[model samples]
Target chain A: EDQVTQSPEALRLQEGESSSLNCSYTVSGLRGLFWYRQDPGKGPEFLFTLYSAGEEKEKERLKATLTKKESFLHITAPKPEDSATYLCAVDFQGAQKLVFGQGTRLTINP
Target chain B: GAGVSQSPSNKVTEKGKDVELRCDPISGHTALYWYRQSLGQGLEFLIYFQGNSAPDKSGLPSDRFSAERTGGSVSTLTIQRTQQEDSAVYLCASSLAGTDTQYFGPGTRLTVL
Candidate 1:
């Protein structure tokens, strides 16, 4: 069975503080890993997609890195607007569905 | 361009009643998906539709849940005999294909009392 687990169920950070969230997965074959930000009362917003280990992608203050067993989402100098639930998902080989991890609730206090 | 859109931002119904939620994927998008999110939980995949191919409904929780996509554009999810446990946000998303990045819409909050 494929499984995804995220660490630090909740994080609190002062504005401009930097931190990283973890997502570890166990799957037969990894096709892709995705990151998303979801606000209250809204659906998830796409963040990044990592297809292989040693790969990284960045957007503004957010950076996503991938490895064989885990993925990390690093938030640098975060602002209040960056506070949201960060979700990680994995697509297994030959599977059309994505398995998601319990998200990390990040709170950036300004 | 308009992203995926779902109708009835909120729906409140009684147990044993039926409900239908609609989704309009981005124009020209070939893939559409449905997911459910309960309070404090992760998104759960419900169904997937790719172009003209058969839908993947393996993730649907029960026989009461059914979905259909018409013209490969609009999709509808119907739940029969709603239960209190069925209350959750039903989210709709679209992508170029199953392997593409999915764009989500504001979900429809369903409340079964």
Candidate 2:
């Protein structure tokens, strides 16, 4: 069965703190890994799509790196505005749908 | 361009009432998707529509749930005899053809009494 798991269910970071969130997956054939940021009462916003192992993508203070079995979203010196639930999803080759992980709730104190 | 849009930002109704939720995907997007998210759970896939091809309905939770994408643009999800378990935030997303990145719309929060 294809499954995605995100660790550190909740994290509280002070402003300007750096941390990483993990997303591990088990799938038949990896197609793509996606990261999204969802704020309260809003829909999720697309962040990155990592298609292969050793691939990395960055945006401002956020960077996402992928591996064979997992992906990491590293936040560099995050600000309070960066606080949101980070979601991870994997698209397997044959599934044609995304399997999402229970998101990591991040709170950056101002 | 406008992003995906969903109607009735919030809805509350009796348990047995039927409900319809609408989604307007981004203009020119060829792929549309529906999902549900409970208060504390991750997004659950419900259905997918791609162009004129048959939609992937494998993710629909039950026969009571059905969706239709007309003219390959606007989509509607209909739930017959809604149950408390069906109370959730229904989210809609769309993507360009042959792409994995999906953009979502502000979800519709449904509550069953």
Candidate 3:
């Protein structure tokens, strides 16, 4: 079965602190890996899509890097505004199904 | 309108009551999807619709959960005789195509007491 696991379940960082969130997965084949930001009481907002190992993408203060078996979302100089649940998901080959990780809830105290 | 939107942002009902959640996707988007997110958990795929083809319902947890898309624009997820375990935020999303990246809506939080 395709599955995704996120580590550190939760993280607390001081303002301007930098850290990384990890997402590991097992799938038949990787079509694409996606990263999303979700706020309380809201749906996820698309962040980045990494298609191959060694690939990376960035947006504002967030950066996503992918490997054959896992992906990491790095936040640089994060602010309280960046605090939210970061989710990583991979689309399984041969289907529209996307297996999602449990997600990392990052809190940046201002 | 501007992006994917779900109706009835918050719902509270007793167990065994039927509930319907609505999702309006962006115009011209050919692919629509539904998912459920429980408190402190990840998103779980529920269903998928692409254009006029039959939807992918393999992810639906049970027969009690059913859905339909009308005119390729608005989709509705109907949970019949809902259970307390069904308490979760029902999310809707859409993409240009089933193979493309998807955009999500605000989600409807259902609280089954």
Candidate 4:
């Protein structure tokens, strides 16, 4: 069975704090890993897609890195405006749909 | 260019009723997808349509859920005999041909009373 698990279901941080959210997966024939940001009552906004181990992508203050079995979303000195639920999904070989993690709810106190 | 769009931003219906949710994918995108998100749960894949090929319905939870894409652009997801467990946010997304990045639209919140 293919499964994706995200740790630290919820996190509260002061403004300017840096932290990392984890997404681990157990699947066969991994194809790609994706990261997204979702605000309240909205659909997820695409962030990055990592296709192979050691691959990394960045946008503004966010960076996503991938490994053979997991991925990490690192936030750098996050701002209150950056607070949102971060989602991770995996697309494996021969699969037409993505398997998503539960997501990490991040709150940045201003 | 406009991104994916869904109609009926909110829908509230009594149990046993039926409902339809619509989605317009980004212009020129060849792939469209539907997903469901419940409170505190991860997004669950519902269906996928790619160009003129048959839709991938493997992810649909039950026979009561059905979807269709017309002209390879607009899609509709219908749920029959709604149950309380059916209440959730239904999201739509699209991507370019042979691409992995999926841009999503504002979801439709469905509530069953």
When 2 and 4 are scored with lDDT, the better candidate is 2
DockQ-superior candidate, 1 or 2:
1
Q: What DockQ score does model 2 reach against the true complex?
A: 0.78
Model 3 off-target regions past 4 Å?
none
Compose the digit string of candidate 1's lDDT tens values, residues B12-83.
999999999999999999999999999877899999999755458888999999999899899999999999
- State the lDDT of candidate 2 residue by residue for A11-60, as single tens digits: 99999989999999999789899999999999999999999999999999
Candidate 3, residue B14: Cα displacement in angstroms equals 2.0
- Residue-level error in angstroms, candidate 3, position B18: 1.3
Q: CA lDDT of B72 in candidate 3?
A: 76
TM-score versus the correct structure, for each prediction: 0.97, 0.98, 0.96, 0.97
What lDDT tens digits, residue by residue, belong to model 3 across residues A31-98? 99999999988899999999999999989999999999999999999999999999898897787867
**Residue pair clashes in candidate 4:** none
The chain A TM-scores for the candidates, taken one by one, are 0.98, 0.98, 0.97, 0.98
Note each model's CA RMSD in angstroms: 1.0, 1.0, 1.2, 1.1
Output the worst ten-in-a-row residue range by lDDT, candidate 4 chain B: B51-60
Model 1 docking category: high
Name the candidate, 2 or 3, with the larger DockQ value: 3
lDDT, candidate 4, A1-110, per-residue tens: 89999988999999999999999999999888999999998899999999999999999999999999899999999999999999999988888888899999999999
> How much of the true A–B contact set does each candidate keep?
0.77, 0.74, 0.77, 0.82
The full ranking of all candidates by lDDT, starting with the best, is: 1, 2, 4, 3
